[model samples]
Target: METSTASPPANGRVHHPGLRTLVQTTRFHAEHRPDTAAVICEGRTLTYDALHRGSNRVAHALRAAGLGEGDRVAYLGKESEHYYEILFGCAKSGTVLVPVNWRLTAPEVSHILQDSGTRLLFLEDEFTQVVEGMPTAPPETVVRLSAFGTWRAEHADSEAEFEATSDTPVAQLYTSGTTGLPKGVVLAHRSFFAIRDALASEGLDWIDWRAGDIALIGIPGFHVGGLWWATQNFNAGTTVVAMRAFAARRAVDLIRDLGITTACVVPAMLRMMLTEPGVSAEDFTTLRKTVYGGSPIAEALLEESLAVLECEFAQIYGLTETGNTAVCLPPAAHVPGGPLMQAAGHPYPGVRSKVIDEQGRELPPGAVGEVCLHTPARMVEYWGLPDKTAETLVDGWIHTGDAGYVDEDGYVFIRDRIKDAVLVAGENVYPAEIENVLEAHPGVAEAVVVGAPDERWGEYVHAFVVPVSGHEPSPRDLHTFLVPRLAAFKLPARYEFIDRVPRNPSGKILRRELRDRFWNDSARKVN
Candidate 1:
């Protein structure tokens, strides 16, 4: 059951406990289940007692390196069981944990390191070459944690010295820019725990896997899904099964062979798993629940998954600033014709969501507007971008910039991005609506819409499309498919064939880059 010592205050503001606040709970599970396995990595395992002691040692080592409250340390590596030990250790030591993106190049990584003013970086040997070349890399400290023994030997019992208070920032997730350069979003300790409590309040109990239950993590640990899985599984005393990288075949084999009871995946990953060779409905019997998000799952895919996996699926939605998830669509909501899949679900227990216009005026149900979220889980602010922060966050509501509509039942239906709206012949057209129409074409595999410069019109709608394998549809055929369905001005003025559209890990199209090529050399950038 959801438990909180304090209640929500007035005007949707509520004070909650901190992230390091759960250390005692960790300690409790450790003492009671000392020898029980806590983590499973490459070929080694660590028990709850071992993880507790190992992290305590990490705290001591970090302190010896001059790390303490208010200092930020970044980690650039793949997801492993040891990652959490380092994260929890930072949580205990009152230091902020900054997880860097491993997919990025050295220069990309350098930008974050320099921006965060990261005092120390803990990286695996795989990234040694990348780190050695970065001139902007911090001189604070560099440590290599290879094996559990190395950490255990240098460890000191300093758990007491490491305590994170409610207001202390726990971690920082650098935003994935759909606009400009990424900004670091700092989350507080209280913010983390409160959201966890909110998840529980909705009868969404943490998976009750015992110490022997293998919890497979396929996504990069730097992402929220991977991080949440590690901590929550440890919090529930489950054994963590780590994957350095994701391979669909390997992920399926692990679940079938290792008895993995819990897992998390994004919509794209789920789609890949369903298409993997030799994959069968029986192969997923060991998976008790699968948590998916990052983008909406199509009804067709959801149905196929329900039939094949035969397990509970939870669709959660939230940003880095909202502490992973402020809303979740539970398994029961997955039934056919149910309202859940059509929405992002209601706000998490302590979270309040509303649809509003640019002026912050609340819109009535069924009206499309920006999705605004107000929660204690909001980050302190965008790191070093006070002006941008003020523009995005107003009156405590983080303007999602996502155009969505809420039904009378409080269900949210995301439409598209406000910035993605294209202007053609003095009319505004949402690319998502156009893409949706295009995706419905049987011969269309993928489609992305962007505004291109036009002499007559300020901007014209252009579509970059991918045709289905073994099927060829001419431009005239494709245009015919849309002409009958959409307004003339909203139709694509031009179309180009492509193998695929460029997208971020979250599956959001990089429209700006698509438009950059032509606009860069144009006399009038907007023409």
Candidate 2:
């Protein structure tokens, strides 16, 4: 297997030795920077001192409700200061916090609640009916976000005597199960601080936080990317700005008015902001750095972002299983036409990566294989799914299930998910390769490629293209454009024009949703 691991710097020293656990970090900041804004959302500002006290009240409330260590306490709401309060409260009280995606259907939400054995649920007022309509009974105790303040006020603000170690499970985030029910990925307190502790002495600014920096959490807290980014900034004692829901126009205004210096988002969000009306470079002057990931970005979109945002761009790659980011494409490597532009970036310090072939043998550099990562921030397990956990987390390495290769210089390049590869006449074709080419077309705004069962080739490429506003490129025009760029077998065999591509809350293209339409009656999903 091709492996890449970096050694720590010779002069490395622990930056925050006392802040090993999330509970300790919250306490440390409260004692050191009590008056600083911990989180700002919807005109509400939560100071570090208030955050600590509020969380303590939550801890008391949870204990009063008879919940104990390792109990699951779920939060089903949008981004808010109160969410963070409950997050830390769970950290302090030893109950595992499960942040449910608010966009999920009633059945989906019920499955998560039942799977996690959630005894209490904290939800927004709008979703009250959703929970009530679930096929299965909802959690026994429900606390509405509207009444959170009053409920929390009933408990004392004194510190909880319960103490948790770094290894204690603090959060359990569910993955978007495209094929089946989502699995709960249990994360420990150390998952939030592993990379930071490892890179403390390296002085690499790939994804750094600083004092007075206002960081925007563009992605929702339900996703690992958002949760990890928020904690990273909080650990550095920086102010965090969260949006109840991400809106392109409102995000621009936040950057301009709040002077947001750092932000984390997905590629789709960046494209939306750039295409929003009346947005200009002046609106992003305060944005010094932007970290993007969740999906591969089109070269054209990256070029536009570089020109318009005029800020440093870093791309991160990882799964919820790896604590959000185990690899980073630093800002310095974001050249438009550079060779490394297509790379996923090198593994972070203290993280190790390798590529393995189908036979489970190590592949040489530049050989396409399944990418696997060994990170200190890796999740403890897929809650209650021992068989799934054993299959994924083997020998302390997470089999990413992504088809990729590691270059000689340790740069990783991801093609696409292995299962998403379209087999055209026995030749493997990754949808990302075709999708990238289609997205680069001036007439195409976005594209999603999936395999359609065919009698001749076993399966053929079918693309769902979202055309650029006011531009319509026909099938022949697209075929002509792709002929010179892609292999004959890799070219799309069919095209369907659409207004928008469907995506999950985390901004990942839901190819399964589209692929299922063509495969529902098929004898086999793949030939």
Candidate 3:
């Protein structure tokens, strides 16, 4: 009957990455904590044993569909247990999982499918028409996840006989850039939990993943912060309750209904929840810890949230390329109106971070420069981009595009971003990508995009356009044109008709000249 599960690979090709794959963790929890809940959403709960069996079926079914080791499979959906099942399934069978941003336009989704050469795509049935409308051909095998139960039933619920180790490439999360193309950050399973596993081995329970802890995931599935934080609990056999989409009321309701003990959100998300009509301080009583990150937090927002939530509030700073949180501002250091709260906390265990000058020389403490990190959590490479991999992962240090400084106490303070990335409500919106879309219009001669300060959303995408001699483009006109090409968050909120965009001798748009006006009075250059 072949009921026995496949054993860990003996190839020695994996070369002892010093970490366990998701497959090993799932099986271990299923055997040791069979009845513990791993995930909960939309009135359904998947216990450890159930998650293992479901993922096993998915792995076997995918392999039967002609997908082999190292093949690429993609998922496009909102948050759900089904997503995790497919993710762990891919992990079990040595297939790479690419989760596309569901909010992306058809053209955006098409670009990923074509770029990755994906063979299989699993998605919600309602989005079938989206795949049909792709600018390029969709994957060869498309499975409607609405029929997942039947599809899984047709395959065996046992581990696929395969050779996969912790070092095997597992996920490819796309991060867009100034080059106007998304770069896939290929990560291994070992890097996924490198920091957490290190902390656990050292017997430190900072975030404290207890057996009965209910972790809340309110972020979108496409972003690493959303999936990465939630799965940390799942890997520890703790219960995780997640939302299909993040909304102010939904996050508040989940806390009330689930007695959620832990959660992570961006600053804007916290503001939205605080301003929600029915929300009261009592609503957040169950939250033992709330982690916020993505963009730097404003002081007033920090104070207000700490006062309202009445829970331990911590700040995490990291990038999709660094796996996750490399620096954390612990609860104790979140003192309002104090010097400690202003700086991002020290690096995580086994993580070394420093700021460097433009010449790549390490800067002394309290110097504003680019932030660089040395951590096991660094991505293996940018998928299929050798030059970028070399440029970024130099000397075992990943160069973060953020301009920041570490204080005498080792607290990192972000001053500005070296990358042309505008963060709108925690979503990374590359300026060049938006500028390209703007310049595509017949009425626009040239365009530049820059971050504008905002009370909410941290920053908004503001575009300055030099109209073509004969044609004039209004804010409404430009907004309407861009709505079809870019995500709503990435679209310019305000448009300024300009004579010409400032440029240097080399013809590079001077984004700093445009950005400086908005942040004139602020000490921090970033919004």
Among all candidates shown, the one with the greatest TM-score: 2
Q: Quote the positional error of residue 236 for candidate 2 in Å.
A: 0.5
Candidate 2 local lDDT, residue 484: 100
TM for every model, in the order presented, reads 0.88, 0.96, 0.78
Clashing pairs for predicted structure model 1, backbone only: 17-190, 18-189, 18-190, 19-189, 57-155, 92-162, 454-527
lDDT of all predictions: 0.74, 0.91, 0.78
Residue 378 miss distance in model 2 (angstroms) = 0.4
Query: Residues 475-501, candidate 3, lDDT per residue (tens digit)?
Result: 888888988888889898888888976
Per-residue lDDT for 88 in model 3? 85
Per residue, candidate 2 scores C-alpha lDDT tens digits across 119-151 of: 999989989888988999988899999999999
Q: Give the TM-score ranking, best first.
A: 2, 1, 3
| lDDT, residue 164, candidate 2 | 84
TM-score head-to-head 2 vs 3, winner: 2
Residue-level lDDT for 143 in candidate 2 = 92
TM-score of 1: 0.88
Q: What TM-score does candidate 2 get on C-alpha atoms?
A: 0.96
